[model samples]
Target chain A: MKKKVLLILLLLPLLSGCWDELYFKDLQIVTLVGIGGEKGDVTVHYSFPSVSGGNGVEYLTAKASGSSFSDARNNMNLKTGKVLDISQLQVLLLSDKSAEANIFDYLDSLYRTPRNRLSSHVALVKGELDAYMGNGKNENSGKTQDTPEFLTQLMDTIKEYSLSTDYNVQDMGSIMFAQGQDLALPLLKMSEESGQPELDGTALFNDFTYTGKSLDITESKMLNILQHNTGKFLRDTYIFEVQGREVPVTYEFIRSRKNWDIGETSITIRETIHVEIDEYSVTPVIGKGEFAELEKKLSAAIENDMQKTVESMQEAKSDAIGIGRRVRAFHHNLWEKGDWHDTFSELDIQVKVKVKVERTGILD
Target chain B: MKPVMAPVQMFLLLFLVQTGTFFINFPSLMIKAAGRDSWWLFFILGLLHFPHLWLFERFYRDFKWTKFISLLYGIYWFFAMVSITSYTVYTLNVYAFPKTPTVVVILLITLVLLSASTSKTSTSVNLGVLMLPLIGVFLIFLMMSINNLEWTNLFPVGHMTSKDLFRGFFAAQLPFGGMELYLLFRYLTAGKIGNAKLMIYSGIWLVFFMFMLILSLAFFSLKEFTMISEPIIYLLKSQEVTFAERLDLIFIYIWLAWSIISLCGIAFAIMRLMNIHRVKKPNYVAAFLCIPYIPLVWYTATKTGTELNGRILTYGHMVFAFILPLIVILFNRYKGRKEPAK
Candidate 1:
């Protein structure tokens, strides 16, 4: 009884004094980490909550010189007037050069720090990270286009094409560390025929450094569907083509059903893509063979696309679609005996696309 | 000495402690240590540790009269104290630099507040009561985080070798390693409790929590894993309650509570050691002893600290926690000695 009393007594003073408890209001929220890398130095930039009455954001830039990553972050606090806040940081972009050289050192610094949330989007840019980050005019005057806006935009753009799933931090780790495979990130390059830049497909990486291969828009869509994972993307797009028509029939991926068969040596994978066709037809030909012909042409086109992708992925020796990972999961022992990735590279891919044109919306 | 926790509590303890903190860097850290095929590495390492865990259990079983840790004092008290002190120091320090208020503030919090509180919980029942809140918060966080979890995350269901299975299991340990505190906790074993049952359930529960946390972590954000610092906390933050913008703030606070409670247990163990050694004013001695450790915590929180702490944790686990317990267990089992007192 005395011991219990003593124990409670012991905890009272300590528990009552909660020294580390800080509310949301107390913290200076940081929204992004913009890493601009040179030959020797790395500059980290983020927008914190500004004290100014009119504008809520306080932009801070910190540059640090270090032989290694930790030294740079240590030097970061010294450079910036405010403490480097990371809890709210939503995005980190690496310049093309630094990503190519190797991003492990810079990335290691973020991994070591606890203040930074791991859900922050990690990406590589075509040119410099700083060039795009804070320098741009604040497009949204009311709300600062800090880290969150860019992350949302990048993710939203990919959503339209039904791109990769969970482009967040944990997946990055799995890609980096998971067995028998390398991780890949979608790289968005800046292209402006207009004033604003748009995010493209993806950049591939072999564990640590960038592989310098960029998948164009369509290929990324193909990669997602082939992997049999769907996000906010519809796999099919179509343009109707009939015989004696000036333009040949064109169909984009709408939906797909795929199946796989594995033998002693090779695996035969087949994808049946359902394409959505959008066309205006005032006079419709009531021909039985015409629909069949459209199916064949569309199937052949999809097959051609699929074949090109498999060949490109094979040549690159990259498993962005995770076909190797899939084979490894289902056939563990057989996978171990063979160089699964090599096997994947040499896969006898059979694309059997079934393109169905829905005339429901067509004005035929 | 009797068993410290009931089967359920033991189970909760394992699940809570092991699973929380490791998510911050487990994937990347393990990758660097093992390789890109780290899931396989963990599978193998997990198998390796099973025997090690068994050996550890056997060691405590043989020396039934004394705790496994008490045996350490007999062999190398000086070295043991340094190891335990440094460990508690590193845990409070390194964790603080990244997650909480600041290194110095957490130091004062853990050392002055938490360690001081531990000085009172000398008995088994009292200690269990003290640890209950930690276990509770852990379960709460685990359940809440699991609520928003997506089943598809574990998908692309691929085959893993005995190698991948082993890596995943060993990787499970980072979240559930709290079972190791059993060495110090032997004093709390109640005679009526099912000992092996408690430990097994703890390990299993821990494994499940780890699998869920790791699966969600890996599934939702593969791209940001390396770039983002704390994956587990981020996982919690991803949850939308319509009330909180970020669940991590609450998550970190709860986690700090758990760590502080655990650290208090460890620090109290040190104070008790000082009392037995006939030291004058054990608290004063503990205070004086803690003076040198603060700088280390400060220095390490700064960046270079992570490497230093990592080497120490890896080596420390190997030398003291991993190898020491295994050798002791094997030796005792071979010698056919009576089991130790719980």
Candidate 2:
């Protein structure tokens, strides 16, 4: 037994490992995220735990790009004494200007780089992150957490928000890699009013560039339905006929599933959803058939909203729904011979929606 | 004859060793063949080996000795030399090409493998079993990767065309190349130890395990598996374990061990052939013969060692892995059931 123990111990060193090791303390961790801009310029900024290491007030700033991101990063070393390390980066902010121009070249380098993890969250900002990250203030300051603490929190939010589905680096690649599909990134607007844009909506795409069509939070609810991220809707929205009064109704999506019926001319997408009411500003008018009527009214509204989002995507020539990808998977031979992306937009999408009310949350 | 390795142990060791080089690049190869339908290609390739294995065993049972290589032509041997030479060269580059005396480093490895199997007595069968568990742990690690499988990624059924299916299915046999083990089995059996089902069982194990594990690796990646090169290692390079810097080190380790084992398996065949023919050279000379293939590989690619998974490796694998077995199976069947030819 002693000899066997010694043999195992001795054989271990001859086998593998200990060739190289990097400790976090010995190196500076870069939490900065950059995006490519026009004229081959890359916007650069990074953050680390401000002085004392553990203290949380971090520093983030940007530099204009005259070269690629790596070169700009090399140049940033001149401004700051520390070398830029991006292996620890957790979030990416692409200004609407950059994404509108096309993010493929920028994304390709990052995705191909050995150090990039492909799991980072990416957002399309409505304005310059430099204004806030450069100025450093709380009001209308666009902020994204690059630390593990908020990553788990965001992952939890992924369960609640279906719109957050195409909001990651992997999501961006999926959109770009798929045929005839315009890519959409979550668009956010920063203002002193809304507390630094938190996933304000989605930026639509044509080719790799943004089409400048963004859906607001309400429209994004239905966009989530089209993406089928929220598999079913457990809560319903309040229906109030206010005679031109904008009724505030919040629908909490629980589950949604879409089936695309490929017709000779138009594509029909039938969506079956499960939903329940969460809030409404008006009292319900109790009648014998009130519940059934409300169900029809809500389903109609949801279906109308979903159709609008899907059509917007179709018009943008974006394949974000991955319908073309679906065909490539199932009818691979036929798709190889044909123009998949063009055929997809010509697809007439007709939607039929179904909803089930679970409950009005605590009568409020 | 070398001591007989247990059929089960040989199955696991062959399954792990053959995959050591192939799986690291399987996702890309499969994707290229089947597009999104690569997993089905892996499954079908595993099944295709069954008929081929049956043909070899039937030929072995009648001949009562070793290989069909002697009956095959001198020019066919040119392709055979080309194929084996290329595979051996590629395998050597993976572990020790740039760092050492390129030829000398490969020769040392070839010697280590030859030393283990030169004995005709059933002694080093234990070595095959000993390496099984260590390699099995790697298999289990790949399976552990399945826990991260995304079912939605495999969305929309029947995605690959019948043509893509044919192409991808053929590509998967690169990992199944060690089916030459029938040659190994014939020597070890020395007589009838098990039935044809031994071959059947090994085939079934290889096909199913690769189907599930390779499929999961393809499906678990963030995007459509279209972007990955050297898919398996690229997948690892993407993974982080809260602390570990790069998971590819595990891949580097597996590649090294597998190269050693495969080189041993190839050497075992060569030495046994020299014995059957009554060649009077030392057994060690047969091992060194594969050494010349190393320089051939260096000429084919850069000496920088950065491109282990490049075109040269794939093409060489095709010549040896697909073409060689394909010819052996064809000629063995063509000879029409010889009576005690061995």
Candidate 3:
């Protein structure tokens, strides 16, 4: 009995909890963080939901500028009156100007801090970040939608359509450190009509720096498909010449089989995609001969677009499709000869796409 | 009276000891040494344990307790326990309890060691059975990273050179350090655990380690292995479930529990060694010996402490835990002391 009492006395102090236990009332849960500017001067913006003075939940955005990324974060903390905790951070945005330099410089704090969230969605902004993160006098003064949550959902939608990938903060670290593969992030621009951030294009990155090049929505979709980085659902729309008039045909991706053949100085990529026709402008009373002709035309069109996407990536000196990974794995001599980006730019690449329409959406 | 153990209890005890808290940084160390070939290199190195276990099983019956060997091992266990507990505190400070004082953390661990040391031997041995459910949860959490694995990261096999292979072997000392405890603790078991059962237990452990090795290799790039000191913890940190965002916070506690259980087992072994030496109040002596660990653990919480711990795990584990035991077993065999004690 005495020993039991002593043991209880010994362990009681440990149960009182440590000093780092964050209280809900004292912590300001920062959900979104945006970084912009160059090496010497850095700007950081923080957005979090605040419930103050008996008002309803409202998101407040705070901005600060300093000489470094950590300096800017510490400066932003002075404006928020409470302890800044990013354990629940959901979205991270980087301006194109900042991404033009090495993005790793801005992301070092997120990687080093143990409490920081690694699953936060990462994107690159095309214009000034203040416009998207909302200045005090901008069009976002009366908006009901949360900018960070809305941008996250918009990126998710783009991923489902096979126009972008799901690159989180942790995923970026692996890709950045990989010798053979580069990273591509979704590019966002403020919409002129609605004054909201929208997915404008895809930002191509060579090594850690933004390549100062981007792809439009159609080309981004083609690049995503070539990389086989599709999400749950992929949709593609193409203009077809039917009955001497240009008609639109849309296909939903079902499944695909991809093969990459690497040679000494050239690479061959072949893919067979099975898709279901989601929308066809013409009625489906066509015979097998017309269906085969439609498949051939669709295949040729997609193959041409895929070739263009590859050329654009090569021109930007970006190996986002991970072709260099295969070369490094199989062709050791080639990988050891020179820098992978330079070699990737000079390589001869070919794309052959075959499209098979599996279903016509419950139509004859 | 001498303490006794059942075969399954012995198995669990050995498992806890061999695994312990060392696995936190084992995968990262191997990856740093062997580059992308860490997964298979670890497999080959893990296979070497079979022969080591075979030798131990063959020569264990002839084992005799000498004052010199006992003193050497007692000192070794004390230092190793301190090193491992210090690492656990350091990792907790980095990942989970940053605000907790080093003395406070070490005090908590010391309390556990004190209680386990002073308790009945069966209590410490039975601690492993309680860990079954938590082990299941750990494996489940580990498998959650499967969706994020990039299979191509494991390519370009056999990329490391001979020097890298040597460095990898040295880096494996901590993970493969505890095998010699089998010979030390074999006498405690009431029933004989045959060679086949030992091999089967090690095989199960090998498979578990391989799963972690392969997952870590596929989850992070080769270059990332150099940056992360503990890839397993960082791997868990990157994972997110619906219920919790930071899985590392919870898993670190579980890891702490495992470390405490392993420490209890070592303390029990120390007590047994004391009993064989005809020391009075052996359990109390063992409990008293753990008092110094409070300060030692505090010292090891610093950056230089980790480097010092690494050196101990390398040269100390090689000489005391491995080579000396082999030499003793060979010497006993040469003297024809192969008969089992009645």
Q: Each predicted complex: what DockQ?
A: 0.11, 0.22, 0.75
Clashing pairs in model 3, backbone N/Cα/C closer than 3 A: none
Residue A334 error, candidate 2, Å: 10
Candidate No. with top lDDT: 3
State which candidate has the highest TM-score: 3
Docking class of 1: incorrect
lDDT of 1 by residue, A117-215 (tens): 666666667775554554455555644334345555766556555654345554465566544455566676655552234666667665566778766
lDDT of prediction 1: 0.54
Residue range A1-364, candidate 3, lDDT tens digits: 9989997898688688757787988888988889988887999888888765665666778888888878987887777788677788888899998999988988788899999989888889987786665433445555444666677688778766776766889999999998799998889888888777988888899999999998887788877787777888878888998778988888888888899988878889999989888887786725747688788888998899889888989999998888888888778887876999999888899999999988888875
TM-score of each: 0.62, 0.75, 0.96
Q: Residue A76 in model 1: shift from native, Å? A: 8.5
List ranges where model 2 is wrong by over 4 Å.
Answer: A1-20, A53-57, A60-66, A77-80, A132-135, A138-160, A231-251, A280-290, A327-343, A359-364, B33-46, B61-173, B190-199, B202-227, B236-264, B267-342
Task: State the local distance difference test value for candidate 2.
Answer: 0.56
Better of 1 and 3 by lDDT: 3
lDDT of 2 by residue, B65-119 (tens): 3345532322232233334334445544442242343444444444455556565
Model 3 interface RMSD, one decimal:
1.2
